[model samples]
Target: MRENLAPVSSQNMAFTDCTKPTDLSTEKKRKNWRNRIGFLLKTNSSESTLHIMKNRSCRPTADDVNQWAQSLDTLLSHKYGKAAFCVFLKSEFCEENIEFWTACEDFRTHTSHKELVSKANSMYEEFIKSEAPKEINLDFHTKNAIVQSLHEPTATSFQSAQRKVYSLMENNSYPRFIHSDLYKELCDAARREGKHIKS
Candidate 1:
């Protein structure tokens, strides 16, 4: 039996299990969380109204898991690998980097001027402002440049900051991720998958 969990907090958002479709309070909180994350996604079902996370359970071969070790980009480009990495980051309480990074990526795909402006503003308040919730570390110059761009928001507004975050992850979290137990467990599972494939 699933129990209602205590409210969990991210850097700026609060989340709890999507208990049911009719739980207005719970639904409301989750909706806010999803909106703050800048990606409101839907799951296939009528019994749910708010869901932001995706199922990250994917079977990987040894080669697939090993490929992730090639580089941070390799891991992030693979859907499952990125999902798994998010979980790892969450465990370390440093998921904001990934969240901000992904939000910026999604920001670029928006075609509407109005939508772009709205997202850019929120992105600034959420991740770029000094001491903003979920703020990623950026140099003084980079942050200043982004603040200036907010006046006439463009698709590339977050590019420089995003690159900085990517570099930080590549040099820091990524090295630790490669050595994390989560990665090791996956590697062990993948090895079994490889052997099973042979059988």
Candidate 2:
């Protein structure tokens, strides 16, 4: 008769390395990183969504720093909606201006009519201070040069003018920056000289 071989007991089965705690922890960290990256990508793609990464108070590894910076670049490249812009502004200028920061955040979180009006007023003031001056120049020759270069009747200039016209049409009913006093005066002077300004 052949020698009988005993069956292996359950306790004698081989131990698997997959069940180790360290391995599980590593897998969990990888999954968390992947999920964070996916969230950043989705937020960057959508204008309505805002991506506020966790504050960098804690010291992060080199890899984490690189990832955060890359995500920020992606977010900036995307077209940010009003809500997202408010959040981004809050994050960017909060330390500089607490009142403005609070107003923006409040507007983003609460859609109250009164709060919106307050936020709009603040934004208007900020816009006037930042953008109004840049739109107008003290030197008339510089302004004329810019206009002439931008409207040379070439394909490139025409395309650029088309974009400007579209932007003005969307923002203002009239294809002009009526808010700027300098622009208004320039138009008046041009009209006096019998020059027609085309959109």
Candidate 3:
């Protein structure tokens, strides 16, 4: 007895192996695999690899600092925001001002806060003398002293001096001119204030 076998046609074979439209999940999976392979091939290319290496090696430049300064200024103008004047002052004017330098030092030496205040006071006086005609107002001087003091209210003499200056400035009765060509008068005042507070 012989058994008859049907021949497989090209169309039948193709239909048997071909995926159906209903099998969308498998098609999606295949597409994802192709995409991953393409990405890998692109990253392995010489140009792409070089670009990645170059980006990693780049360093910050002066332009970066300028941009950062501009950003800081913008942030500072916002109300109740995380703005800092100290940062601006340090970045912009600290290098040019001696008083700022002394204040920074005073900040680090908590024990010598009074001395620092005193030193700042003196420096302001000197600054006024050197930059004469643009006299240092009593309020400015008092503020400098207070900043240097770091919130420390020292001896009676120091307190008295600060009070006197404050009173004069507040009353707007302080003398506008200095006599006897007193050089380093501001420095002297700062030094005396520091000494009195420290003692």
Candidate 4:
């Protein structure tokens, strides 16, 4: 008989190296960077066009964002309006208002009928539905209008509802966001870092 083979035990086989545990802070930073890149890609073309418009400038300084915070009208009227509002809202725990508003904005940009229908349905399900995770506060009339519009999706189908939510945030949430300690901290941090107002 030939020599016998050895048993496949740890002593016989080579051991594989173990990977080090991941740093949660590093992972979080990586995720944040990825999200930032994704947002930039989504708004790249639109932002480029707006960049050329002096009044709608996309590159805002810290002071500009601070100034925008002084009035809800000024903040929402900016080309990158959601940029600052979203950051502020996140801190105040009222981010759904801006998220729904921005989703409506993106919904209106779809040119294809199929895409319009798809996005409209998702938007309605997510924000207009009574118990949706991100359900928006809407009046009965506005909610009914969205229900009727779902049959034939159009660019402006969500306009009325969007306007209502915009008004709600502007009147109710904006004042608190502007004066919150988070706002002051953001401005202070920006001043120290010498970075543009990105949120």
Candidate 5:
């Protein structure tokens, strides 16, 4: 009878290694990196949504249709206005402003220090860094302020940049979106449906 065959210890090293104790601290680091990657992936998905919305015109409900016709402040304040404005920015190929503004809004809701830092870095790399893909037009002072705050990012790190973008949209893009055919069609539909528009 032939001797019973046995697996070599070296051959079983792979299986043994799989059962080794994992470093808890290292595991935590891995999880943090994963969260960071998730943040970036989410950002990409947002742009994808913008692309989709750009292809289709907005259809506002009765309550919001009249809100867009009001002052820019009123329009920007309402959820419907923000959505419509994003579509308008996408159409203009300048959705970065709105994206940055939205990012800022998200930052305000963060309570964890780790999450705040991670998100702030992601935003800076994506929208604030030189030659960043989504860099918005910002004044020297505003850019300088953002750069200084990166050392220890806070919720307001992007405050100056956000304000500048908001002003740009309010003064430039907001007016144009109001007159766009998309807006006109939405307004017309509301009227045909007998929706009362606020003067």
Candidate 6:
């Protein structure tokens, strides 16, 4: 059985310890945030979505792309880098890390309690829950911390979980992304653009 199992990364944990959340005081709040986080805001006929970022089609310059190599923070801070990395992760089916991280980034901007609670519970269901649709690999302690925070649903509710996921991406996903063909294509495009600029 062990041989059949894939090697686990940092956040990907055995979820035999799944449990229910404690703080969602009302059933309404639970249902609202029960929505799954999606990678595509793809149109079939009618599709209204939020939190799912449209992949920025904008290109980055060679210098800008090169900056990403310096650190995970640099890559994430640059809009194109963020978009490109999101694409890369989507290819790997681990877009949840970036999705969760970005969701948390968006989470902090809300000042109203209603907005905070709403987004917090949604994120909890989408990523933190043991069987979440976009379930992210999280440890027991970190998972518990976020679960506890969700009861009150503050802007910082998912901060620790976000940081943990960020670390996982920085260590695991970012390195692979840097080497990925998708990134290489961006670099190639940047190089071509640089040559075009010179001539």
Residues 85-176 of candidate 1: C-alpha lDDT, one tens digit per residue: 78666655578889999999999999888998899999988987655887666666677788788878899999998987888788878888
Global fold similarity of model 2 (TM-score): 0.23
Q: Which of candidates 5 and 6 is the stronger one according to lDDT?
A: 6
lDDT of 5: 0.63
Residue 106 displacement (Å), model 4: 0.8
- How much is 50 displaced in model 6, in angstroms? 30
Q: Cα lDDT of all candidates, in order?
A: 0.68, 0.29, 0.32, 0.62, 0.63, 0.67
Q: List the candidates' TM-scores in order.
A: 0.69, 0.23, 0.22, 0.62, 0.64, 0.70
Which residue window of length 10 is worst by lDDT in model 4?
1-10
Model 6: clashing residue pairs? 11-137
Model 5 segments more than 4 A misplaced: 1-59, 194-199
Q: What is the C-alpha lDDT profile of model 3 across 1-199, one tens digit per residue?
A: 1111111222132112112345446445444433433312224577855653465223222232223234433322332111122222222222222233233334345446566556545544443232333222233343345445544534321343334433332222111111111112322433443443357
Candidate 3 Cα deviation (angstroms), residue 59: 9.0
Better of 3 and 5 by lDDT: 5
List of clashing residue pairs for candidate 1: none
- Candidates by lDDT, descending order: 1, 6, 5, 4, 3, 2
The most accurate candidate by lDDT is 1
Tell me how far the alpha carbon of residue 176 in candidate 1 is from the true structure, in angstroms, after superposition: 0.9
Show where candidate 4 strays beyond 4 Å.
Answer: 1-60, 76-84, 194-199
By TM-score, the candidates rank as 6, 1, 5, 4, 2, 3
- Of the two candidates 2 and 5, the one with more favorable lDDT, higher being better, is 5
What TM-score should be assigned to candidate 3? 0.22
lDDT, candidate 2, 42-141, per-residue tens: 2334331323224222222233322323343332233321223223222222212223323333445535556545544443344212233112111233
Q: Which pairs of residues clash in candidate 2, taking residues 3 or more apart in a chain or in different chains?
A: none
How far is each candidate from the true structure, as Cα RMSD in Å?
A: 13.0, 31.8, 37.8, 17.8, 21.0, 12.9
Pairs that clash in candidate 4 = none
